[model samples]
Target: MSENEEGTPERTDVRKEEEDSPRDRTRLSDICADVKISEVMSEETTVVRESESIEDIIELMTRTPYHSFPVLNENDELLGVIGQDNILELLFFERSHRHHHTHLMAIKALSEDASTLMVHHPVTISPDSTLCDAADLMIKHHIDRLYVIREKKLAGVVSRADIIKKIHGLRRQ
Candidate 1:
C-alpha cells in the first residue's frame, strides 16, 4: 500500500523478493539438507577384489547395471572405485583392436588387475552423513557416486541417481 496524502506509511511484502529469487530454486542444499544418506543408499553393492584380473573385472562391470564398483583388498579393505572415468581407457584400448588409433595404449597387452585400474584412495562418505553433505562431496569432486564407509569397509553406495530418486519419492509422497 502506498502512502496516503495524510502521510500514512506504506506496506509491502518482505518475503516477495526472496521467494522470487532464482538462487532459491537452484541450490541442491535446500532439497537435500534434511535427508540422511543412509536412507537412500544402495546396500546391494557390487564390490570387486583388487587382485582380480582386468578381464574378470570388466566382465563383472558389464554384467551389472551399476556404472562403478568398489574395489576391495583381500582383507576386504576399501581400496577404491572402478568408475566410468576409469573405464574410458579400457574402451579406447578395445577400440584399438578393431581399428588403428592415433595412439597405442600399452594397457592393452598388460594382464593388469583391479589394483591397476581402480581409482586409489577414492573419496568416501560416512554412513550418517546428510544427503546435502553427499551432494556437496559429489559436486566438489565431480563424481557421480560415493561409497558410504563404516568401520573402514564399504557399507553401501550412493549415486546421483539415488539422490534424484529419493527426491522424486519425497515429492510424490
Candidate 2:
C-alpha cells in the first residue's frame, strides 16, 4: 500500500480487470457473497460531529481524502451523513437545482452546524452484512460508501474502492 496524492493509504498492488468478463463476474459474485463487510471495512473511521461548524468540516475535508463523513451526536450515535456535495451545493446555492432549493438555501444560510447540513436517514449496512448486501445497497442508492451500523452506532465504513480491492485480491489468488 502507498499513499495517494492526498496522503491517503491506497492499494497500488490491486490490479484492474475487465468488469464485463463473465468468468470474472462469476468469481466476484461468489467472493462478494462470502466476504463480510467487517472484513473489508475501515475500522477507524473519521467522522464529523453534529455540532461541528462548517469551517471545521471544511478543514477536515481538506486534510482527508474522504468525500463524506458520518455525523454523530454527543452520545456517539449515528445522526446522518454530510458530504462534499452538500457543502458544494450550499456554497453555490445560486445554481441550486432541487425543487426545495430555496428552502434548503435558507436553512443552510442560517445553520453552520452539521446537524442542519447532513442528509438524514443515510443508507447503511450491518457489520455482519455480506459484501454482496453492501454492494446492492450502494447500487440501489447510487452511493459510493456505506456506513456500517452496529447496535445503533457507527461500526465502520465500506467504500466501493474497498470492494473493488477485495475482488482484485481474489482474482490474483
Candidate 3:
C-alpha cells in the first residue's frame, strides 16, 4: 500500500504480473521500444486533392489547424504533399514575381492548384516500421509527419505528436 499527503491507503499492486519475475520494475524506454508505426498512426487522414485550388488548400490548413497534408490524385493514390512552409513559399514567390498589390498577389496564387504547389515525392513509411525508424526518418528529413503507405496507397499518417502520445501513455514514469 502507498500513502498520499492525506495518508490514505493507495493500491500500488500494478507489479502483479512482474512480481514473480526478476524485472519487477518497468522502464518507459523498454515499454516504448517495441512500438510500431501501425500502433500509433492515425487512420483517419485528411488529405487534399490534386485538383483543389491553392486557396482551398490554404483555407483547409487554417480552418482545420493542420500544418501539413498529403495530396492525392484522381485515383486517390498519393501524389505529393503540401505544408505550411510550402504554401508560404508559394505565396512569397507570387508576391515577388507579380510585384503587385497584396490582394492581387493572393488572387493570382489562388488560381494555382495542388499539382503546382505540392512538394512532389514526400517521405513515407511502412506500417511495420518501428517508432525509432520513424523518428530517425523525421530527423533525417527535417519533417514533422510521415505518411504510412501500403501497396503504393496512403494508409495512415503518423506525426511527432502521435509518438509523444504513445510514450506518454506508457505511464512508466
Candidate 4:
C-alpha cells in the first residue's frame, strides 16, 4: 500500500480552485468607510505658543513622546512647528566650547523669541482628505506627519504610523 494507506489515510494533495470570477476592486469609499481623520489622529496633541519660553518647550519635549508640535499664536492660529531638532541645535550652539560664554549668552538672549526658531509655513492637509492623499503629501514632502486642518483650524494630526496601521489591517483581510 502507498504511504496514504499505511498511515492514517494521508490527506490528498487536492487544492481548492478559485471560482473563475473577477473580484471587485476596493474603492476609495470602501477603504475609508467608518474611518475618519478624527478617528485615527492623535487627539491629545501637544501644542506650544509662539511666545513660549525655550525652557518650557524643552520641558514639554522631555515629558512627551512627540518629537514635534504645532505652534499656535495668541489667537490660536497655526504658526508653525517646533521640533526636537530645533531645540538640539540651540542647545548645542549655546554649549559649544569654541564660543566664549559671553558670546553664547548674547546669542541666547536674542533667541528668546520662539517664533524665530519655529519653522514657518509648514505644509498642512485637510482632515477631509483621503488617507491616500495624506500619504502622498507626506511622501512628496518627505515628512513624518501632517497637521490636519478643519474649517481652517487645527483639527488633528496624522502620522506615518497611522497610515501604516491602516495598510497592515487591509493586508490581513
Tens digits of per-residue lDDT, candidate 1, 1-173, equal: 67868887654443443455423444546667778888989999889998888778778867888777899987777998787656776656655555534333454335378877776767788888899898788888797888888888788889999988996666544
Stretches of candidate 1 off by over 4 Å are 1-31, 90-111
Q: Candidate 4 vs. truth: CA RMSD?
A: 9.0
Clash list (residue pairs), candidate 4: none
TM-score of 4: 0.68
Q: Write the per-residue lDDT of candidate 3 for residues 1-173, one digit (tens) a residue.
A: 77878998764555543354334224544555588889989999899998999879888988887889999988778999988986886677645654554674455455588876787878889988888788778878787889999888898999999987886566534
**Residue 172, candidate 3: alpha-carbon lDDT:** 36
Q: Which regions of candidate 2 are displaced past 4 Å?
A: 1-24, 94-100
For every candidate, C-alpha RMSD to the true structure in Å: 10.6, 7.5, 7.0, 9.0
The lowest-lDDT stretch of 10 consecutive residues in candidate 2 is: 13-22
lDDT for each residue of candidate 4 in 5-103, tens digit (9 for 90 to 100): 456654333211113322334653367554566656766678988899888898889999998989988776778898887677667765645554566
Per-residue lDDT tens digits of candidate 2, residues 1-173? 76889998864433333433335667678888999999989889999999999999999999998899999998878999999988888877766666647775778756889999888988888899998998898888798988888999899889999988876677667
Model 3 Cα displacement at 59 (Å)? Answer: 1.6
Error of 1 at 101 (Å): 14
What TM-score goes with each of the models?
0.69, 0.80, 0.71, 0.68
lDDT of 3: 0.79
